[model samples]
Target: MPKRKADSVLEGVPKLPRDSSIAHHTQADYIEVNSFVTATPCDHCLDSGVPCMIDRSRRYSKCASCTRASRVCKREFYTGREWDLLRRAEDKLSSDIEKNEDELDLLEPELSALQSRLTELY
Candidate 1:
């Protein structure tokens, strides 16, 4: 029969203090929640023909329309599968660079030898 306070709903919840008023709903709280709800999708998701919608509850950033793993979302906004893909891509790029460097090293010697032969012939 009595009117319950807005903060009464948060009773027993850890981190948040009890006796806090609904009026205590700060601008920061709204901003934080809004950020969780709205985030930019990653480039992969954009390119994959999937709309990158932010899922606050998703362990991985998944497509809101297809529920598929989204590569366009950031780790903060979306975790799990898509995050793994981003990491793997980074690793592959590093490996490719190393391979290119190795090839260049091999070519350097042959290039020097060719130059030396041309000089001798001249």
Candidate 2:
């Protein structure tokens, strides 16, 4: 990500160092759905001293509070396995669409043949 020139200029201004104690935890939606939360670092990228809060959920071990602290600490982060699962789902959907198309094509000809036979009988 590119920082705007105006934002870059602000860095020249003298500023007090951040106080890390008051930072809160954060959550990552992408990670939490697939993996269990552990005593990972805070998800939120705070000043540095913030600690992650604990979550006991079986699906998501970490709470939203920690998600805010650090991206690396996010409990809900996805692994390679989740990405593989997504790819598999997309493949299955594509296969199903192809199968339905084939079925439709077969049915259309059968329907036309049946109509023609009825007309001849009449």
The local distance difference test score of model 1 is: 0.54
User: Which ten-residue region of model 1 has the weakest summed lDDT?
Assistant: 66-75
Backbone clash total for model 1 is: 3
lDDT of 1 by residue, 1-122 (tens): 32678567766767643334332334224333433433445555455654445445443333443233212333244567778998999999999999999999999999999999999999
Query: Candidate 2, residues 1-122: lDDT per residue as tens digits?
Result: 32887777787687753544223321344334434433334446233545444444444444444444443444445557887999999999999999999999999999999999999999
**Residue 79 accuracy (lDDT) in model 2:** 58
Deviation from native of the Cα of residue 90 in model 2, angstroms? 1.2
Go through the candidates in order and give the clash count of each. 3, 22
Please list the C-alpha lDDT of all candidates, in the order they appear.
0.54, 0.56
